[model samples]
Target: MSLWYFLIDWFAGVPTFGVLFKRFMINFAWVCIALFVMLVFQLPAEYAAIVYFGFIVVNGVMGFVFLRQRMQMRD
Candidate 1:
């Protein structure tokens, strides 16, 4: 496998920290995508801010759901 994939898989398998690490990476990806869209479309400052806020809220909800599912699966 590629080095990047190997590293990601290794980190993801780590006991407790792995979950947090994966969540952080997912959130970071969302932020990066939002920034890319804003820059590429040349959105106004107000619109960009709103888009960023929406992405954050969506990420939070997704993370919560993911964690909840993980907990349910563990039971």
Candidate 2:
């Protein structure tokens, strides 16, 4: 998807963005989905999105920690 490309481009050293925006963009799909349901499906999407984003953050943190340990072990 285009959003994924944007994230990769930003990760590959776009000068304008830093880690915070990168993380937010990584999770942007959920925000967009939440918006769509509110507009189209007539559902309460916000609370579910908050939970989804929380899960995403937790997964990202765990992945980062796992990768860091792997690199340290390799060294």
Cα lDDT of all candidates, in order? Answer: 0.68, 0.58
> Across residues 1-75, which tens digit of lDDT does each residue of candidate 2 receive?
699896455334323225545555756666667666766866676766676777577546645655565567679
Look at candidate 2 and give me any clashing residue pairs.
Answer: none
Candidate no. 1 TM-score:
0.47
With a 3 Å backbone cut-off (N, CA, C), the pairs that clash in candidate 1 are none
**Steric collisions counted per model:** 0, 0
